[model samples]
Target: MRRRTLIRGAAAVVLVPAGLAAATSAAASPRQKSAQADDLVGVDVSNYQVGFDYARAANEGLDFVVAKAGGCQLSEGPYTSDSYAGHVDGARAAGLRVGHYFLTGDFLSPREAADYFVDNLHDYRSGDVLALDVEVLDDSTRLWNDAEVSTWFNRVRERVGAYVPWFYISTSALRSADWSRTIASGARLWAASWGANDGSYPGPPDLGGSYPDWAAHQYSSMGSVAGTSPIDLDLARPWAFDVSGPTDPPGGLPKTSAEQDGVPGPTMWKRTQNWLRIQSGYTGPIDGVPGPNTYAALQRNMAGNWGYTGPIDGNPGPMTWSAVQRLAAQHGYTGPIDGVMGPNSWRGFSRFINADAWD
Candidate 1:
């Protein structure tokens, strides 16, 4: 009973161990509910140009992008092809759904890795995704145990929130790790079982490679998209919006769950984070951690410069929630500033958050 069972489709059961219960306590916030395949079309960019060219693949029908941020440093040299902030901005400008990934290994302790990831990626805005690039077999000396890996993932999620979906790269290197026991627990599985698409899988079969809610499969590395260079397999679907239907303009900000009674504190916090990302041109993960970058962006966009002053800290407090509510009201949302965001509030904010305003 302590275990959480995630039922996919009809009879498929995906069980998350009780061990991960505390780590991923927050629920997956409601996304726009687009069909998985429709939103499944995204690719990872590492050795590409410095800036993302949205218009580059505009003709190829590229719907989303997952890029490398930073991970444990290597003695051979640090990979500096792209900074986290630049990728976020470039992807946004290029009209692509964006996400960030970090290489994982014993390069640093889980807490240190977490802290490094946070510090490096504080400027992410509302519309992007944050992913951990957790596959590499260099020095096994710095890798974390399962519990540590899970904790690190949860820490990232708690900080990033629902706007950014957490994805794991399931490959040979990752599957061979000791922490492999809990590989696909809370995060979506992005399978890299490269094999012949002719009904033959060449990777580890028991690698927890099968999940009903599995978001994507990287079936091949010898494929190519329209504008980009040849790379791994494409996403099995298209990009999805966080909320369904037409979202209203920006509205009033969030209030506390304690203060709002029925409203959930985490949900309000997520709304605050989402609003700041949208307003401040941040396209990083939407988790609720409120790192330095998230704070800096909030400060930059607050009322004086088109942003209502929210909590000055990187964290989302009542003031930030209030600002979101008011801004949304400007776009025809008439919700209360009580901070208890029901479907009505979300619908309103969704409009502005995913609006043509980016145009």
Candidate 2:
């Protein structure tokens, strides 16, 4: 992969003026020398903001946007923001480099949330970047720790498809958390160190949460543009994304490592329950039992999608077996959907939703 030549100073002398930060150094030269167009300007928005005029923002010299698409609610659970799609379309219509972020938390498995995020959000398009906006730990409880942050970002790595997902966070948070080195190795970072006029970076512009320089810096959470009073205005160095490389081939486990190979164990059954809870109509505990409720939900899902129509009595009858085979067929099993779930179905099941254990 090709790397760009990045500017260095470690820390800025002072905050640059708001608007676009690229030309700050030029503005500071004693000889009145013209500085190269060094940085780009952008904004981030979410459901909280009333509205934005993307066309006006573009005309005002903004170069990019990082909008919010989803949020992690400790008690309420994960949900897509109401306005993300509109914001994205409007920003792109205004001809801006568009990206998006999703707030994360510590309640669920980081990987599980990441998977859901990737699945539910809009597809990534050209020039689109994804970010983990680790803003709050929890409203009423603990903040996300290093381990949680690491799992979130690491899982994010596998699920972000082609986009390079950055870690958007505050400078104080970066300094405080245990800091996931795993995330640092693969993810870009956007540091949130706010001031009155934060649209520009002054020093080496490096952030310490395991990064040499922050890919983007949010100078003001209350930035104004196109007449909007408070928008997240950002200043970013020229950023390039490396979207190609070897990612581990997906699939191969029904759940992480449930009792070794094909052998079905109580431990494996429990893990299956954990994965199963995410399916529709599963309102039971993850007790690892293949009880009526569990099988009922499974059968329900398989019925319409996998060509099954037996009584939903939570019974693992021929119809249920046929459904599993059909589901596996969609994933990777080329064989017939017979009652016998052979190696082909096992491989496909692993591929479709395999985790070592419960997510």
What local distance difference test score does each model get? 0.48, 0.57
Residue 57 error, candidate 1, Å = 0.8
Q: Number of the top candidate by lDDT? A: 2
lDDT of 1 by residue, 53-124 (tens): 556654456667676676564544223334456766767777777777666665576666766776677357
Candidate 2 has a TM-score of 0.54
Per-residue C-alpha lDDT of model 2 across residues 109-167, encoded as one tens digit per residue? 66777777777666468457777777654431545666666576666656644455567
**Candidate 1 regions with alpha-carbon error over 4 angstroms:** 1-39, 48-52, 76-84, 137-145, 171-185, 197-212, 236-359
Which ranges of candidate 2 are over 4 A from the true structure? 1-36, 137-140, 183-185, 197-210, 240-359
Query: Scored by Cα lDDT, where does model 2 land?
Result: 0.57
- For all predictions, the C-alpha RMSD in Å is 17.7, 18.8
